[model samples]
Target: MMLPETLREIIIKSGFIKQEDFDGAVKSARELGKNLTDILIYRGLISEDVLGQLVAEYYKVPYISLSKKVITVDLLRLIPEEAATTFRILPFSKTEDTVSLAMENPLDLEAREFVKRKTGMKIDIYYVTAPDFTAALGQYKKNIQDAFTKIIEENVEKSIGKSGDAVTLGADIPVIKILDTILEYAVAERASDIHFEIMEDSYLIRFRIDGVLRDILSLPIAIHPAIVARIKILSLLKIDEHRIPQDGRFKFKIKENYIALRVSILPGFYGENIVLRILPESTRPLALEELGLIGHNLNFVKQNIRKPHGMILVTGPTGSGKTTTLYSILNILNTTEVKICTVEDPVEYGIKRVNQIQINPAAGLTFAAGLRSLLRHDPDIIMVGEIRDKETAEMAIHSSLTGHLVLSTLHTNDAASTIPRFLDMGAEGFLVASTINLVIAQRLVRKLCTSCIETYKPSEEQLSYLKNFLEDSELTHNFYRGKGCAECGNKGYKGRVGIYEVLEINESMRDLIIKRVSAEDIYKEAVAHGMIPLLRDGMDKALGGITTIEEVLRVVRE
Candidate 1:
């Protein structure tokens, strides 16, 4: 059965998907003869857990995530495997008179009745996502690590004494299987990036998990060349040319899901060092509010992006999620009536209906040139990936002044620094003051693991440091932090969230900019005008239990 419109409305009201996307998914579901839930999950418009939660909320049932749940053999024996498989259910826990069962379709009367009769106890039903349910069902079989060990052992023996050229060795079945297993393990561990480092005697493989790198496995240096060659073959790079750096990308699949891997290989002292950035192919741009834009910052971005003509600049150092913020804004403004064009150094993700151009400096199509062409194309909104030079900066400002909403990024420490950065690029004071609407500076901090987050009163020194930014801070206030837990791999952090400072250019700030004031002076003026500083925003989040003070300090300056 299809997802009811009421449940779709619940998801939309919860800010997970837009009305237009939901309607499109509904139409696509009809055309493809698939249910609405499958279409939404397949398209990555909404995650399975979130959709399941919405479904549970609509049905007034409990929702559960089976990711970290451990099901014992005795619990699995509550219901027959055939019945569980046929009904798409799992018996997770059991007591004397009650059994807790997780089901993908809790509304199915047949499944519930079958489960109740089989268990002969009061069944505590929990709604779970399809992926989670399927994964839970796999717990009935062999252990995941055991399966990996078997594959690795068999492959290592197969390649023990085989001698061949790098290309030939790479084409070997054992190397292929080993590489596939490594990739599968990385995906299973939710790695954002994979690093292959060559050493004198060995090759080390590490996965960057939650922004931290940990060694996964090591192999003999003998097979390093074969591994490199295999990666090059997969990414379609030249195997013979290891002296020069090469960049390429390829898609890797695990089950029904596909991951887009961006490959970067550089010649190192030992050998070629490879780094792969893992991006899910089906993922879409997240909503603004979901990007950790809370309260004022959230409201400010919402209001400013809707303006007919102005420039919004997101500033941060490398890997601070500046591109993500830009994509999110573009996602909001993307519509049929308003044509949005972008010129990126390398286009990251393809957004539907937005005209994207990759900047090819070797081909003479720089940001300035592409932007100039876009202006001739008569676009309502423009996105320049970065304003790296005076020419592109001028063009972006010109576009904003010429009745187009422009979004782009700059490499600056904070919101206040963006103004001075523009002036340093030779942008005039009046032009900088007039065309810019808002400046957002952000940094990503690891979020506290919710499953094991604990709260405690801050120390006197910590309280004093936090009070420096917040005036109304109290000494008795308790802040939250994540203790080590299995769910977070004992790191106390699971994911990341952005701490932002949004500076809205007003009359006084514009005047200060036109007068060419120092960045510090502009920062003070913006603070007086209700602009939250990055440290203050981070502290606010820490106080609210979203992250720890230490995590905030790790990224933002005190």
Candidate 2:
């Protein structure tokens, strides 16, 4: 094959291949290496383009080096007229022994050499940027215009008017703009989750705004995998490994504000499904008073928190705002004099003046092992990440009983359920009663969008349900629901508020635990002692229009 002899020698000298290796191998292998091309292919040394050039060179045909040659009208003719016209190269000139061509990118050396050899003339090349070249192309400019028009038409048909205002040219589209628009809308709508789902013909984008899923936009399916990969890459999740589930977190800075994102990926039948949890940089902490505990109850809890001894348990189901409540209590109690230490699975937020340890089981630093070691540090306050097993729970309780004020979280549905959770972890009732100072249970409910809330008279059935849940015989006249509006993205809700149920460990409650009282009975006695249930806190928000009746019903219903 006639590749440029110089280029062939350059390749050979580059140590990419050995001539003896190719020749002997080709001669010996009858089926696999029948030709030099086959030998090169087997060795994976050169591409088809390079082989083609070699063949052209062996035949002594004109060879245009794309990398080193200048672009001229003759080379432009080799390109499809549609592409050449779109790029605006035209008007060739040939004199007796020289060709003077007016073309775009005339400095493209590959184009200049091809033209010089093909026309058999000395070449003079002129260079112009796009706009100047288009203007110089003159009458032949119609060819460029027609080519672009066809591309625009094809792109429009493919896009199916989904983004009418945006223009597309062939396979290349300005996708970043569309992503930005969707993100802006999501932020404006106070969406908690952004869903990008792939379909057969189109990609679907949806926002989980106000606890409801709403479709935002759609695009051609050709772009779905790319967009998905982009999101995965941004989240620092595995992009190339698609067989297993992965979790990742990332933060985005937009307009001087940072947004935290937690991404979870799982394999789906069609492709990977992703869920992005958007956590705003700023959020209000749930204070004890804001949690619907009366002043006396708050004072009691505060006194216990301030005691300098005993463990405080914050118990709730997942996504119940347990971390926020614990952090608030820690913030209240934190001071320069006290040495506070915390071990967390993943430290969500950093608190100044507190030493926080991130628990990594993979590194052999687990909650139980970390807690057992933390006791030696002699911290005034200790925070365990969670009581997943007996060892950690016992260690935390022992620390509290010894002298340190300990705080930790447990997975349970409510305050009363926490006792059983601890017991299930092999904690003795008497030891739990002696060590635990307080238990705070909480849940989050969507707040009614202030921009779109409307007062409404409750139906008898709704009123009856509310009275029974409140345990109040009287029905109040004031209640509200969210009315859809543009400001709230038509979801009638803006944000979320926490509803809490606090259980304080007083002498009577401790004695009841010692007697092995049933969880239901203990709850009843606590209610009698003026402990407000989570349902009441939710009701108060509903009555005040902080949230809607439907939201309270959804969160607090049995």
Candidate 3:
């Protein structure tokens, strides 16, 4: 019962990091009483997948990535839930006499022996990353739909017998439990938003997961008022006022982490329809690589963010991942030598050593006003959440011109149109041309579920549509799509990735901008200068099997 080489030794042998850094992580791991690998991953030193592979190489076992792996319920049932949870092991494949298991620790003989004895078969071991292992373990949890049904059936009777207004039942035990179930499950499912729709006979509960809306439950109309009231009460909104729209937010705790949920209540014919947007707890901003920027686009962002003074504008519609890109850039620029300041409508994340201001129009602290004040702070970098008007747009341009790096977002369809959008906002052509450095437009498309992604030849019509955008149709020989699986909730897609077009303002393009050319003309020049169009970028992803053609078309067309 001997383990393979120590993880620290393997990490050093693999040249993953300097020996001094590994030793420091090992010391912190010992102090925190946590796994060495966990500490490294948490601190953003190494990725889980790469570390898993490194361990598997030393342990002489196969490595598995479970992001898209689909394991059947029957196969999962072979390992008891408690044992699987305790050991971080899952059965992914099985044969007549052999069972293949993916484990976070391939050296855990206890886990291997337990699985072998339970199934009465030879066990084959495979290594899996911590994130993949945790996600796969969710397969053992009870079905969400079943849990929802059970909670409602048990509490419907209590609400059925008594009736007053929403506020009265807001405090009722039955109503509270029902509402709690929805919120709890929504958070558990990684839902971005929850929609409560009032209908003629029933109230519909829907959860928006991975950019798609799904109906979760339907309750009688009698339950609607109480549920709305409960949410309103929790969010500290005016529960009694039903005529006007109301907005508020509240923090919901799950274990040690707190989730901030924004609530919007609107008047409707049947009743008040409510929508709750679940905001994730501020954590580490993803690296640019993880956000789907690669090759030239990645290099463009990297080179420009280091410049001392210029404007970098990320253009996209709402929910298109504009803010995330801004945050990622800020994460790269965050250091002790320079001061960073930001003014946002609502500050999305709290970055250490950065000054962030949330916009309050009511208090006369708008983006324009905030930028003016941030200038006096002698900051090296400034981020404006958005440029919504001429005043804000002009102020941002002015900030960039005066020897300060500026990052901001604007609502535009593509990178080429961003220049014209500035002009439309009444920004001077010379100022826009001189101070602008880069413009990036992006959209999020559902990534094809790795476990169920299927490839096929393109149709003639699809090819024709693509040819209008792609010069070399040979790349379209085979495209991938999700075939729906239990792992992806049968949606064929599991997560989202960004598709971007980066427009680097070179001298030629900058000259055209100062001349006030049309966006179409500017777009042509950008493509000529090696800028990848959004549709082309998405198409490349589709060809690479990162996403489906339909998913790309579905998003880009909008």
- Residue-wise C-alpha lDDT for candidate 1, range 430-451, written one tens digit per residue: 9999999999999998887654
Q: Model 3, 1-558: lDDT tens per residue? A: 122457557777787777787767677666534456765665557777888888788778999887777678788779876688799899999889999999878888888888878999998899987656766766754455567678888997778768777678898999988887888789867788999999998889999988889998888887787888888889888888999999888888765678888888999999899999888775579999889998899999999999999999999989998998999999899999999999997876678999999989989999999999999999999999999999999999899989999999999999999999999999999999999999999999998765455556677887787687666746445566776765577788888899999999999998999999999999999999999999989988876667887789889998
Clash pairs detected, candidate 1: none
Q: What TM-score against the true fold does each predicted structure earn?
A: 0.78, 0.64, 0.79
What is the Å distance of residue 193 in model 1 from its true position?
1.1
Which segments of candidate 2 are over 4 A away from where they belong?
A: 1-181, 199-202, 210-213, 282-297, 464-467, 470-473
The local distance difference test score of each candidate is 0.84, 0.66, 0.85
Native-to-model Cα distance after best TM-score fit, residue 60 in candidate 3, in Å: 8.6
Off by more than 4 A, model 3: 1-88, 91-138, 164-167, 459-466, 469-476
- lDDT (Cα) of model 2: 0.66
**Which model scores highest in TM-score?**
3
Report the poorest 10 consecutive residues by lDDT, candidate 2.
163-172
